[model samples]
Target: MLLMSRTDNAVQRFIFENTDIRGEVVSLNNSYLDALEAHEYPEVVRRFLGELVASAVLLSSTLKFEGLLTLQARGDGPLSLLMVECTDQKSFRAVAQFRDDIVEAPLQTLLGKASLLITVDPVKGKRYQGIVPLEKETLAASLEDYFAQSVQLQTRLWLACDGQSSSGLLLQALPASAELSADARSESWNRMTALAETVQSSELLDLDHETLLVRLFHEETVRIFEKEPVRFICTCSQERSAKIISTLDRKEVESIIEEDGQVAMDCQFCNHQYVFGKEDIDSIFNEKPQIH
Candidate 1:
């Protein structure tokens, strides 16, 4: 069964007519699966990764900047951390860390006393970061709180993932023009949020963008924009790994060589391992460092 069609593997933005409401939809299949294959995550971690992947895509699509957005969750549970990063170029990467015997449970069950951290890094500008405590029952609810606090906008999000495929929908009230009254904008936001809350996980993950829009907002007119492709691309290599190794003290490097006969570094995002034996370490120490 085809979970995501080639034509459907893009981020889409839409706006409602005669209202200050905007929304985005993202369906990730290949990118979601690629992130999963990078590590042997538990079932709970897998689900969290899926949600993070979908949420990252949805958030990146709505932003009006050319940069990267990173979504991460850290907790004091069996599942320690989960992260997803996506750039305006449509490239992305993700990874998760968890104990082997993590129980299969809901988002709250797996991540006790957790927090969500979002970072936006522009290619040529200042970066922005937001940290929100995980007080809600689900990842989607926590994100809604983040949006409410950061943007002060009425926002709703529906996120879902089934190991292989992940998808999400986000709707937010836009800042109204000077002519529009605050009460009018508030009323419109409440009405649209009510409509957005009825979205089912099955519909969000399985249905295409057009079908989803029609099912959820048939009563309203929404202008759908062209979709942008989302893909999985890891930015890790031996050269980068070597550069990182160059940062370590020479004593620390020699200690690893003395204990294990070699030093190995693995890319958490791609699972690509780089090994440096004594000779490799010597060459690294002997050669002049190049600016990376």
Candidate 2:
């Protein structure tokens, strides 16, 4: 069966038979709603968060390692930060930060002069990071530029989200094999990308996987694969927070305890707070000698 049964929470990948074109489709519901429940975000911020969540999931599907892909956008604007992280397990988490006075505006208007930073951290290897200026107005466009610059691959992405669900569609041209002519691969890539551009955001977000695929690629022979489930899984814990506090200098730790009564750390992704008192701080630092 080329079309897998719908499981309500899975990411689907597909490949064209005769073309060196591959794609991914992801729809996030429960995971996305859980992230939004952590805070009261403005509508614009929520929408941006949804798109980001979908984009991260789509990109993570392309990886072949046990790692995490983090997409972050930072700018000096009302909406200061937005981030989404996806791990090899297909787990994901996301959050956004904005000023109190942030008004409802389009994403470009909200995050002017921003930059998209993508970081890949392998479980046992050195981390890789890429920084791309937000030259395009939309998240999808900027990510397309990232693929162009970093991977030298032609890519197209359409990301969309309502308050309840987030979804995205991605198409990338595979590199030509040694046996294939470069011109032949390039021509196929161009044709495939043009077809991919016809995918509408509404279709991507609302239609069923089979219906959407047939609608978009009915003219071409395509092979669809089984879907992978994507879910929200936070990596924050009290132990992790304590370890973070242990790294700070004794004086700085003491100052936080003195001013706030306890050193409190909050996970930006989950809004889970960890509080450590003076005694806890002392225990963490007492074992190590001070560096003079």
Candidate 3:
């Protein structure tokens, strides 16, 4: 199924009634494509970016701050870096770095000796980051381990991308709620996760939130909250890029402008290009940069 054809770009949060298990379902269409269009990525990079996007959105739901959460992977192989940044408002952008001649291969071969980094940058407080070895073959597995060790949450993620759209399903074992015996609580977590283990990529991409939930948990009571919208929003602009140029040494910016006639730069995240003329350069360096 083509997930881009789906009209709703939303993430649905749901909980099993009388249980402490909460989960999220996400589908990406335009946002996923927007992130990929800036560069011509290989098949492996495309699919890898998709999974990272889905995972970022899923992890963003767990934060309580109005800031950006970033997931970064880097290694010594042909594929050097995979980065996804998502905001608390459910918007995201991603980028990757790789050698020009790298071919698709196993995860470790594409990105040998890798480590994963999860960072939360709150708008009003200190940032926090957790680092772990990317010892798993799939991004999902690495993330599952991150949650297990870093947050002490039993989290499972299923992420899929087919070069057009990306989708993900996340199941987390929250603290046990009241109104259940210890046995019932334990059984509930175990049984629900076992059922979720049956979910396939096709089911996640093809099924709507409600139908998918019903299909998976019809025998179990569940409550889905209002769906949240997800969007493709980039934090790049001519204004911001110019400020970065301002921070550089004045002579270097002038030398580059003299040689190339202008300083042209592309945003690392969205690949949006920005060009600075002589006047723009002077204004940036001689005066304070204007921000909107």
Candidate 4:
């Protein structure tokens, strides 16, 4: 069991003793609020973004990569996109792009013909991407379907967000050991998921890791692990911003600087502005290898 406060921004993992089942619980407080503060998202959008953030943290913990994992949902409706990214270090950020007149509606209605894209980018290895059409009513359901198709393990997700606090729980069935038969593994997975389906959104958001886990799985032996802190960390820096500028045509960049006195780049995730004067632009162009 974890000793951290219930309201703390953290994630904890647990395993069922003597079983090949593992789970995770995550709650986002300040990090969720900070992501919302970056834009003027509606309450409905805020709630969805919260769930995305919580889900990202939960899913990132289950991965074997050492870099970044991104979850992006895109469509051609009022709600154009919802994206959340989490790194192996437990830091994450989220952003949403939508029409100004977007209103509260069903997930499919909001994102017409939408699809969920999961991208895993390891710092040293090759990146992997999985794309699946989003045809469910809720984000969690869509993700559950994705897992069912992409992975061999049985995976389940429970997510909730009230625009203030967001939380999620994940349970996955690992490969059966030599001691445990396949029937036993299936039975355990079924029983545990059935119990988890009884969880309420309020309980997930309000109860701490220990209390919540005990409430759900009191009949079983659960071994809780240490909590890992999660925070809002934007990976935008002036150097990275400069790299983007280098990709643009030098003549066009010069024209922009001539008219506006300086070229500016704003990050969509954090809204941080990066400005480059003439000298900075000159230095960047000079440092680059000209094809000439």
Q: TM-scores for all candidates? A: 0.91, 0.91, 0.92, 0.95
By TM-score, the better pick of 1 and 2 is: 1
CA error at residue 217 for candidate 3, angstroms: 1.5
Candidate 1 structure quality by residue, lDDT tens digits, 1-292: 4544323457889998888888999988877787778677766677778888888888887787998899999898777788999998778899887777888887776777799999999877899999999878889999999998987777788988878788889997777763198888878788778888898888888888988888788998889999889889998887788778877898899899999999999999988999989988887778736645
Runs of candidate 4 with Cα error greater than 4 angstroms are: 1-7, 289-292
Residue by residue across 67-148, what tens digits does model 4's lDDT show? 9999999999898999999999999989998888999998789999999999999998899999989999889888888899
Q: Write the per-residue lDDT of candidate 2 for residues 159-243, one digit (tens) a residue.
A: 8887778888888877665318778777877777777778876777677787788888788888999888888989998777777
Backbone clashes in model 2, listed as residue pairs:
none
Question: Over all chains combined, what TM-score does candidate 4 have?
Answer: 0.95
* Residue-level lDDT tens digits of model 3 in 1-292: 4333342578889988778889998988787898888889998888888889999999999777899999999999999999999999998989999999889787767899999999999989999999999999999999999999999998989988888888998988877665357788778878988898888888777777787787788899988989899888889988788878877899998999899989998898877789998988999999866553
Sort every candidate by TM-score, greatest first: 4, 3, 1, 2
Best by TM-score: 4
Give the runs in model 3 whose Cα sits over 4 Å from its true position.
1-7, 179-183, 288-292
Model 2, CA-based lDDT: 0.84
* Alpha-carbon RMSD, candidate 2: 3.5
